[model samples]
Target: MILCCGEALIDMIPAKTEDAGTGFVPHSGGSVFNTAIALGRLGTRAGMLTGLSRDLFGRQLDDALKASHVDTRTVVYSDRPATLAFVQLEAGHATYTFYDENSANRMLAPEDVGALPEDVLALYFGGISLCNPPAADTYLELAERHAGRCAIMLDPNIRPSFISDIPAYRARIARMLAVADIVKVSDEDLGWLYPGPEALMEKLAALLKAGPSVAIMTRGGSGATAYLRDGREISVAAEPAQVVDTVGAGDTFNAGVLAKASELGLLTPGGLAEAGEAEISDVLAFGAKVAAVTVSRAGANPPWREELAQERPPA
Candidate 1:
């Protein structure tokens, strides 16, 4: 199973009311939540590890996960309110203003996290969870402690504004990159992570040297590339789709990658370390395809199993 560890929150998406006036509609979302939902919809055995409240929004988030077939057994509950991300979409692109102070997600401490079940082969970590202080420290501890137990996938999804301590945040991320087996990053995230005249591939190379066996980099319209620590690289074109707001496109892309990895029996630490170019390339292509489906629709809706062709190879 792929265990996603992070925050679960409500995304107040821009919507049109009956009278045509713009309003915000609550959507069950958060980077990690979206990935878990996408993975479940894609038929992967996925679970979420986060703190949730008993509030209506939290209940909605819980129901959304159960509806998508993601396991919520590992979820920790609190009485605090849910985090709210008010989204702003301009021309099918999305940005966010998050209100997370003292929310359930932000209050997670290392002690609040429980033990993982034995079946979890990979842990997916990233998003704003790494930006929030106590929760950030909690997840970092979990990831660091579990690094030897299973494979790790991380996508910083860097939001500079959310980070209050640049140096500490960098230190945490640097430690995580060293332990992660697979690291997915965006061009913008790379620029923010290692700003300067370093070429894109150079930055990718540095990431590989840091520790991850495979580094995947996505360039919004240009497609994505997978780089191996031993110097192999594979690139895939983004599947075409009618553009809608790109809310969970990247998150679903992550789900697709994990789903394919699980299907291919490459969801293990050893599998990731020994993965070949063709397999990693196929995973990236699958991710791009899934992201296409997401961007073709409004909101963060990922494709169900019926919407896509078979992913598993014939026995």
Candidate 2:
């Protein structure tokens, strides 16, 4: 089973153009939440481990997860308000302004992680959960404790504006990377976190030394690259599609990687490390295809199993 741990919140996306000056449209989002939902939709046995609010937005989020067949038995609902992110889309990309300080998800503590299922095959984490304090510490602790038992995947969907202390945030992420077996990051994220592309290979090499066996760097429509610790690199180009919006594209990509790995029974702690280049390439291509489909749709909606099965390879 894939256990996704992180924030679960409501995204208040602008329903119309800024020139129209309209109210926001609500959608259930949160990096790990989206990944979990996508994994479930892709026929993986996925479950969520996070804090939710008792508000209407939270209810909607739960209902959406249920609709996607994600297990919510590990979710903790609190009296505190749900976290909110205002999404503004421009040129197919989303700019988020979060209103999450002191929200329910931010208040998650180490105790909450104790409820995680014991038989979990892989634990997925990322996003703003590593930005905060007690919750961040809790996630790190869980990652360390379970690192030997299950494969750990991390997607540090970094947004620098939300991070106040860059050094500290990088330190926390380094710790998480030390335990993660699979680390998926974006080209934009690497530029912000490490600066120039010249330093990328060095930085990724350093990350591989930490623990992760495979590090994936996504370049949006240009496609993605995977660097294996064994000195192998494979690249895949994104499939072409009519653009809709890029919301959840990365999360869906994460889901695709995990789902494909799970389907091939490679989600075990060391299984991914030993996977051949051909195997890795196939999985990465599948993920990129899934992301392409998601960007061709609206909101965080990802392709179901049938949709993926019918997708043609990128030309």
Candidate 3:
């Protein structure tokens, strides 16, 4: 099973009301939450570990997970209110106004990160959950605890507005990157992490030196490029799709990469470390394809496994 560790929250998206005015409609989402849902829908053995309130929104989130077949046994329950992000879409891109102070996910403690079951093969960490205080430290602790026990993937999914202390967050990211087996970053994230006159490949090389065996850089429409620790760089064109809203595109992409890697038996620490160019290419292609399906839909909804059966390349 692949365990995704991070925030689970409600995304309040704008929609036309019966009265013809725009109103916010609640959707179950968060970076890690979306990835878990996508993985489950893709027929992967996926589980989620995060803080969830017992409120209506939390129950909604629970139902969404179960409906998508994501294991919720590791969720920490609380009476604290669930986090809410009111989304505004402009030209197929999404921006959020978060109301997360004192919310359930924001208050997650290190003790909440319990022991992992033996079935777990890989762990994924990312999102705004990596920005806040106790929760961020808690996730870092989780990664530290299970660093070498299983393959670990990190995608900072950087949101600058949420970061209060840039230097401190940078330091935290550096530490987490050191233990990550796979690290995925966007061009914007790269600019934030290593701002200067340095070239893109140089930044990726520095990222590889930090620790990950594989470093992936995604450019929204242009494409994505993967840099291996052994100095092999593989690039693939972006899968074509009619854009709806780019909310969970990256998260679903991460899930696709993990699911394909798991199917290829390359999700284990040793397997990922020894993966060749062909294995990496296959994994990345699937990720791009899955993400294309995601961006073609409304909100963060990802395709079910059967939805892509016809599109799957022959074994």
Candidate 4:
């Protein structure tokens, strides 16, 4: 099973109400939540680990996870309110105003990261969960605990504005990178992490040296490239889709790659390190295809098994 760690919050997506005035509609979303849903829909054994509230919105979020077939066995419960993000869209791009202070997810601490079952072969980390407070430190501690021994995949979906202490965040991320087996980062994230005239390849190489066996970089619209620690690189073009919104594209892409890798039994420490170019190429292609289905629609809704049943590659 693939265990996804982080936030599970409501996204107040902008919508046109029947009254014609614009209003926000609540949708169960968060970077890590989206990936877990995508993974479950892709027919992977996925579960979520995060802090949830006993509030109505929290129940709603819980229902969404259960409906998605994402295991909630590892969830931590609280009486706190849920985190809410008010989203604004302009020319199909999205921006957010988060109401996360004192929220259930934000209140999570290091002690809340409970133990996992033996079936959970890999742990996936990312989202604002790694940027926000006590939760970020909690998740980092979890990553540090499992580091080189477990199959770990990280995507620090960078949100520079959300970080209050850049130095601490950077240092923490560098520490996590040291033991990650697979890392999925965007070109924009690379720029933010290591600013200046340094070429993209240089930054990626630095990440590889820190420890990941596979470094995957996604370039919006253009495509994504996978760099193996062994010096092999494979690039795949982004699948075409009528532009709707790009909210969950990257998260779903990570899920897609992981789904394919897990299917091939490559979501393990040794498998990732020993994977060949062909194996990595197939994973990237699957990710691009799955992400295409996500961006072709509205909100962070990912493809369901029935919707993309035929898209599944042979195991």
Better structure of 2 and 4 per TM-score? 4
If ranked by lDDT, best first, what sequence of candidates would result?
3, 1, 4, 2
| Model 1 poorest ten-residue lDDT run | 306-315
Segments of candidate 2 deviating more than 4 angstroms: 17-19, 309-315
| Model 2 agreement with the true structure over 1-315: per-residue lDDT tens digits | 899999888989887666886789889998989999999988889999888888888898889899999998888888778889999888878999988877778888888766567668889999988887777777888898888788999999998887767788888988898889899987677666667557778878876887789999998879989998989899999989888999999999999899888877788886777988787887898898888889998989988888866754333
- lDDT against the true structure, per candidate, is 0.90, 0.86, 0.91, 0.88
TM-score of each: 0.97, 0.94, 0.97, 0.96
Candidate 3's C-alpha lDDT? 0.91
Clashing pairs in 2: none
Give per-residue lDDT, candidate 1, residue 57.
Answer: 95
Give the clash count for model 3. 0
Over 4 Å off in model 4, which ranges? Answer: 312-315
Candidate 3 Cα RMSD after full superposition onto the native fold (Å): 1.4
